[model samples]
Target: MHKKTMTFRCLLLAALLCPLASVAQQAPATADIRDLASSPRWLTTKVYIEGAPQTDVKANYPGVVGISTWDPERNRYEFFYTDTGKSKYDNGGGGYFFITGDHKTHVLVPDVGPTKTMVRRLETLNQCEFTYSREVPRDMVENNPLVRIHVVHAPYTGTVETLSALKPGTPATP
Candidate 1:
């Protein structure tokens, strides 16, 4: 494996496995934007679009998108990905995203069965900066290799962006 690819995977593994508990042994105090226990909740300041999705979902998921509120109680957030063309994807249009974990890390796992969704990972540094990424070999429908990555800063209000900044350097699947 190439060094860059390995490094990226290590980083992702860390993000995916970050602990969500405040009870863990304290070392340094870093802010966890995913921690929605506070009031007002986390809001999307901007969304970024990088590469492209499956041809079928391409029309719906855009380069830049807006995000909805993060509901802690429901552990879910919502967003719509539509191109200016204003066309709809053949799948299920856009569906809701369910995120798991807390504080240290928050991730959108792969969907089982029929949804055919991708795994999205989000790491919000502050109200202004955050990273959202998706690396699925075949998105929405099978055989569509889609990888999206968005490293957003102020003016940061968002959702799905295809592989630009964060896509894996190597093949995601063996």
Candidate 2:
């Protein structure tokens, strides 16, 4: 039993460390996940491959806005967006995301289907602007080195203005 337990522990440690080892060898990314993760302002304006459309989100949603509000309790970023490409915009939504050990260079975005994980790496994050590039399987050929996403901050609206006037703990009207 002792031998079996020791073997199991070794396997578990290897399972964790190998993935992180690769991330550690990589260079630092300019964008801090902390900055993008906390703000409610990110609006996904375009998702493309150099000049071509790359994802369905771009095809379906004309003004595809993404919003993230910091969840102080969870310690993870929650993604919100205009639902399924129908875009009256900013109805307040939620989503899931995962990050790697380095907290830079790599980001795991939940894909549209089960068992499929879309991997995005940081390209550029200039102030409120952000760009992430996706990785596709090697069997697929492409001119673009990256499948990219572009985002800029959502402009403050009347709702935002009203919310600003509220006291710290006060909730804005629905």
Candidate 3:
């Protein structure tokens, strides 16, 4: 029984460490984003947009707009957006960074449309109203490198101002 237990522990350690080792060695690719999303341990970031303030409540904030996952490694945030063609733009694709309520955590948003309209919209706001959750018990999504936020406003509003009034997101440094 003791021998079996020791062998099991060693195997578990290896199972965890091998992935980390490989991640550290190479920058993530497009396929990696898909893999991470499909992983049983994938994380989901809850997106929100500001809505009409309720006269009934002193402070009313809108709920999540959408949810999406990205790489959880802090150093790898840029890769998730840059590596995936989903985020590309004609004038050199880049991303936007929005800090959360804590003033420490950040979310990287990529342009989801044909023009820089999304970028222009992000410029209007000041505070990001997004949040995330993790599925795996062993991992965390907070303060980690999350990328590729595709803001979706239902019913196809032609104007970005119609979305929310939370805060603007800064463009990721080239």
Give the best candidate by lDDT.
2
lDDT of 2 by residue, 59-135 (tens): 53333245434322333333443443221212222223434445434332221223222344545554555565544
Candidate 2: residue 13 Cα off by (Å):
15
- Candidate 3 has its poorest 10 consecutive residues by lDDT at 117-126
**Alpha-carbon RMSD, candidate 2:** 10.2
Lowest-scoring 10 consecutive residues by lDDT in candidate 1? Answer: 165-174
lDDT of 3 at 46: 25
Q: Candidate 2: where are CA atoms >4 Å away?
A: 1-30, 51-57, 60-65, 68-75, 83-98, 101-104, 109-116, 136-174
- lDDT against the true structure, per candidate, is 0.37, 0.39, 0.26
**Candidate 1 lDDT, tens digit per residue, 42-156?**
2333333444322234334343343233344544333333222221222322322334334343443221223333444554544445445454434334577765444332332
What lDDT score goes with residue 79 in model 3?
A: 20
Superposing all C-alpha atoms, what RMSD in Å does each candidate have to the true structure? 13.9, 10.2, 18.5
- TM-scores for the candidates: 0.37, 0.42, 0.19
Superposed on all Cα atoms, model 3 deviates from the true structure by an RMSD in Å of: 18.5
Angstrom error at residue 114, model 2: 2.8
Candidate with top TM-score is 2
Put down candidate 3 lDDT per residue, 28-52, tens digits, no spaces.
Answer: 2211222222321111222322231
Ranking by lDDT: 2, 1, 3
If both were scored by lDDT, which would come out higher, candidate 1 or candidate 3? Answer: 1
